[model samples]
Target: MLQVLSSESAQEILSTLTSDPGTASEIANSVDQSVQNVSYHLDRLCEADLITPTKTWYSQKGREMTVYALATERLVVQFSDSTD
Candidate 1:
């Protein structure tokens, strides 16, 4: 979980999923990345249970696609102000 989140690409993929669920192809387009790259991170997020397949999108060619959405509503990260 922490490992995946530490990745910039994974973070970008997660940000896109936060808005709504999408297939790897869709996310790749939105993030301006290759489908292969997006698909890889999606697998990581799924393994971490951070995202899940919520729906399906079928193409005109009859290919079924899995759509992923955020399993967790929010993620907060804060840094301590202490100089020590």
Candidate 2:
């Protein structure tokens, strides 16, 4: 997850998803990015198990929307203190 979050754009996207689930377009709008770019990052995020499809709904124009939310609410990392 740390590796995946290394990307600044990915971090922005993840922050939005954490607040609430939204479709790619919605995320793009919220993040002030192109839909295409947001969609690409969404795919990577899903692959990394950082987010998951939570619900499906329809747009005003009848387009289906898939919303994604954070897969893990919180993560903690602690490095070992061993001397080698």
TM-score against native, each model: 0.86, 0.87
Q: How accurate locally, in lDDT, is each candidate?
A: 0.92, 0.89
lDDT of 1 by residue, 6-30 (tens): 9999999989988889999999999
The predictions' CA RMSDs to the true structure, in order, are 3.0, 1.7
Q: How would you encode candidate 2's per-residue C-alpha lDDT over 1-84 as one tens digit per residue?
A: 677778888999988987888999989999999999998888889998889998999999999989889999986677887994
Clashing pairs in 1: none
TM-score of 2: 0.87
